[model samples]
Target: MRKKLFRATVLMVVPFFASLLIRLLYVTNKKVFHAPKSVGSEPIIFACWHGELLMLPYLYFQYRKTPNAKVLISSHFDGLLISKTIEYFGLETIAGSTNRNAAKVLIQGIRALKDGYDIGITPDGPKGPRHEVADGIVIMAKKTKAKIALFNVKPTKFWQLNSWDKFIIPKPFGTLHYYSTSEIDVSEMDIEEAKLLIKEGLLKHEA
Candidate 1:
């Protein structure tokens, strides 16, 4: 009985806390990425670091303003939580990984590109040696010939929770720095160079 009640309570409260956090963040920072006028109408593959996942929903929703945009997610429990939360924000998820069902997800991403919806990915996400970008985003961009946006976000203040990824949970009413750099040139990359380039970018950011 105790276990049953505990599970029930957690299910109820976890979502509440998630929603509360999202609302608080939405009200916090208003300045993030502004879609460029020329790039406004094209499909893009947006990449960001893993730690900033908590605040991504707020950013996504603000840009969407309507029902659009899709993200690639992993088939894991944490992905379950993020997928649910993303859906709650009216975004869609295509479940896959660099190792599992990757082709399917890439195809889905291509379809999204053709449909005029952009694909967003955490270059160091799902699981990570925190902030280490992976080659997956570049591979996807190369396949789809989609422009890449290196999404970046920083919080003025936040607690870095003790998780494998050191997830950042931004404080209520905090400031956030968000922007994206120009398209990552991935056309010449094979798997080897892609991996090296990804690590280089990660090191650049960490530096």
Candidate 2:
């Protein structure tokens, strides 16, 4: 019982500090935004590789200061940490993954879109065979008739973890070069076609 209480306490406290640390790193780093023309006022889908997830919440906030956005996250422990961390940046979270709670993701994702909330998803996330586009993203876009935006950030100096996604941590004081694609409409494409487009768009700038 004591151990469980300590573990619960750790979960609640870590995300708060983690978010602060992320902000610290970002504020010290040089940021270059190479954004395209705005996708206008309509809610749109945002997709990126899972490896690029760390700095994206901050980027999203820079793009849409009056944010009405929610990120799709897994229902597992790490996802809880990520969900709470991004919440510090005023982003809500939808608890689901491509592998677990998938139906919940589809339902909540479409609902969020129809209600004018932008949704962010890491296509091959929460257990990735890295850099692959999952079907859930395609399904959600089709259901809501929303456009998808592909995003990527390249850091001048960073540490790459050996994790499945080879997660990146931009070293403080280095430059972060950001890029985003124009809104992509997958509403008319069949599932396989849409997934291919998404995967290609995301990997276009990959090293």
Candidate 3:
């Protein structure tokens, strides 16, 4: 009972504060998006490295405010906390991972896309060999014909965590640079080629 209470409290308080911090920092910083104007209107699969998730919510609110923008999060306790946090910023979450229950999540993603939702995924996530692209995003794009917008976020000043992905946190009031590649048509390439293409796009602006 005590453990449950602690978890509940953390879920509520941490997201609240984290959301506030993100918003505060966002307003004080500058960002640029290298995407087409039509990007805001189309349902796209937004791919970024797992470690670069800290500022994504801000990007969503500022630019990609698709009505049905949903993020793919793992079905784990940490994912729960992250979902709660991003929810405060007005994006929905779907809980699943490539490492577990992948088919179920892929089906969910397809359904969301059919309903005109833009999904966010960290292709190398839920446990990473750091920056390695996975096949899940490629498969989803192929199945749904959703354009994949591969992007990277670079903070001028930040701290890196010791975790596997070396998670990044931007300093309060630092500039963030955003870059994206042209929309990828997964149907034009096989999964292996698509993965390599996405990885190359992401690495172009890696910080």
lDDT of each: 0.68, 0.88, 0.83
Evaluation by TM-score, superior candidate among 2 and 3 = 2
Each model's backbone clash number: 0, 0, 0
lDDT of 3 at 196: 95
Where model 1 places Cα greater than 4 Å from the true spot, the runs are: 1-13, 29-38, 61-63, 191-207
Would you estimate the TM-scores of all the predictions? Answer: 0.79, 0.96, 0.94
Q: Sorted on lDDT, highest at the top, how do the candidates line up?
A: 2, 3, 1
List the lowest-lDDT window of 10 residues for candidate 3. Answer: 58-67
lDDT of 2 by residue, 71-181 (tens): 999888888889888888889999988778888788999999999999999999989889878899999999999999899988898999999999998899999888888
Error (Å) of candidate 3 at residue 186 is 1.0
Better of 1 and 3 by lDDT: 3
Inter-residue clash pairs, candidate 1: none
List residue ranges in candidate 2 displaced over 4 A: none
lDDT for 103 (candidate 3): 92
TM-score of 3: 0.94
Query: Cα RMSD to native, each candidate?
Result: 3.4, 1.2, 1.6
